[model samples]
Target: MTSIEHITLEVADPTAARTFYSTAFGLDAQVRLRASEAPTTGFRGFTLSLTVSQPSTVDSLVATALAAGATTLKPASKSLWGYGGSVQAPDGTIWKIATSAKKDTGPATRAIDEIVLLLGVADVTASKRFYVDRGLAVGKSFGSKYVEFAAESSPVKLALYKRRALAKDAGVPADGTGSHRIALGCDAPSFTDPDGFAWEAASLTPSA
Candidate 1:
């Protein structure tokens, strides 16, 4: 019953990363944590925590990556997106470095949780039945092809549409580039809609 608490991104520089994420994603820079304010345990909201690496460590990381054949694509720079940087792994995998400015204020005290994943499917009725038959409880209808499924304390919403239509809405090529599945938590079974988009459920476990 492990739940996903938050997502963290390691950045080359803290101050630059913070400024970039705040500007690019429209995230607020309300919370700032000093070294003493690090968390001990439990769930917290989506937060951007910064740790300044020692000079030697930073140099070693960059050297080791380059020696192993990583290409420096975007050298670290202070941009509108903050201090942005990227490197291309030997296999052509691009790694981006940026700081996120979101904070997780812990779990919701009220009855509901926030929407974690948005799933798009080809057929609404068929997709709804797939989840319902699998023991997921369906809530009120969201729209023509959208429905809500309650997963214990967590809530999952599914949006149905043609594959092409969804791609158009997202402004990404429908060519099936990138990932077909998105993970939820550690133990939760992965789910995919009729159109092939995958979704994972995030919730508070018993321990939390």
Candidate 2:
């Protein structure tokens, strides 16, 4: 079964990013700074979705992230889908905290139940096909608007959405170019997806 294993976020300051993630989500340090020659001016077209067990947990996380220097993109609020919100980490990585208050079949956790890499792609169908061809099994999907890939042995799920829609979801502008802020760690041979998302071949390292 295909699994994400790990997800790397390119940031201007790896040390600061590592600190922010650790403080905000109790995630271990796992960021690599961009080379001096690399330009750091793109949205990365993705958001890290952290699924928690309940609404209060979502609020607590959003608050923690904000206190840790994350910029609030959307304050925690309840919608028909559930209670959640978005924030931009100090290093510019967008993080989404969400909860449906549903019981998790996965291991019980007080804070984060799972982490999902949500990519904003120009062509959802094409990108979906790209991963499906590369061994990703489709989970729940809604036409070309959104799609989720099942996580087998991996703790993180991979998902795709229309670029503009994802921007709206993250409460950020959709217009972006250059390096995506995130990278997928996988064993499927390093390759770029149709929408320009890169997957690096690497072993999984579970975060704290």
Candidate 3:
């Protein structure tokens, strides 16, 4: 029954990053982290997929992000996968605002229903094994193309995809440099995934 307790992202300006995410996505500001030294610069091969219940929620969130200083990577539109778009936050982290539900203009709460931390792995099959070995249960799979892990009590859903395929899906280039700038809070002993994504054990959980 493992789950992602929290996600930490390194930002040059934690205060501003926190503000942008909080205002745009209703994410708790405390999740943002400020490194004592300069953090790496460039694209991080991952995305925070905020899943909402209503179709209109996707548009609303995308609009809120842009107005709050995010750069649009993709405009809101209907797609076979769902209705949504992608954006790079003020701090350079990517986010995908989407919903699988049918189009509806009904009101939605600012709080996100699910936060999926999707990693663009060099090998999806290998990455899936890494997490499973670390205690996350397999939730769904599509061979090497995609895989999802079930979270216990944690709200964040962890998933993996082929690095290049993921970039194409998000309409962005695959090239990246320096740190991925993402971390996961889990019950497993602290370790880095094959692609260098770190997982920090939650305090309540003992080391394996």
Candidate 4:
């Protein structure tokens, strides 16, 4: 099955972005950066999720992000689904750090268990079909609302969500245009999805 190897975010300053990511998340290989002056505004049609083991880890990561110049979109807190919060990086990418466990299992560590890339699409059904035809396997489905793909051996998991709902979840407005300012690096051949998300064949991306 096709799997995401890493995600590349087009930023205005790759050097600063690399420093921010390294200091905040200590990410090296999983997230890559490229210099781009692409005009993008408001919500960028997607959010990267960092899933950890417990609430304390969520809090720790969030704090580190804030210290690394990430502004808070939503303060970390407990919810029905667990604990999570949204933060916008200095480069304007939204990241949601969360965990299913509401309580701390142990001491806090910045170990991220999973990285999920959620695309906000206009039509979930149509997008699902687009990916399924491209050799992606659906791991979870909830009718026309949401779908999660089984990305085997990938550093990132892929999922689809309705644009408006996704924006609300990310604590941002639904309106956005110009560029997604992001691209997915996957094992499959290059293709652009219906919503204009560009995916390319997996390749090694050096840290900026």
Best by lDDT: 4
Task: Tell me the tens digit of each residue's lDDT in model 1 across 37-155.
Answer: 22222111111112112222223344444655556755544444343344444322233333221222343111111323334465667877776675666665655556656535432
Clashes of each: 7, 2, 0, 0
Task: Give the TM-scores of the predictions, in the order they appear.
Answer: 0.36, 0.88, 0.91, 0.97
TM for candidate 4 is: 0.97
lDDT of 2 by residue, 16-117 (tens): 777787788888633333422245565668888999888777877888899999999998888888788999998778999999864334543446788888
**Which of 2 and 4 is ahead in TM-score?**
4
Give per-residue CA lDDT, model 3, range 1-208, as digits (tens): 2888778877777788878877898887225465424446555788889988777788788889999999999888888877888998888888998888767757765657888888999989888887777678898999999999876677688889888888877778898877887677666678887898877876643221
Q: Ranking under TM-score, best-scoring first?
A: 4, 3, 2, 1
The per-model lDDT (C-alpha) reads 0.38, 0.78, 0.79, 0.92
How do the candidates rank by lDDT, highest first? 4, 3, 2, 1
Give the per-residue lDDT digits (tens) of candidate 4, residues 120-202. Answer: 99999999998999888999999999999997888899999999999999998999889999988877778899999998776
Give per-residue lDDT, candidate 1, residue 22: 43
- Model 2 scores worst on lDDT over the 10 consecutive residues at 29-38
Predicted structure 1, TM vs. truth: 0.36
Q: Name the best candidate (by TM-score).
A: 4
Q: Between the candidate structures 1 and 4, which one is better when assessed by lDDT? A: 4
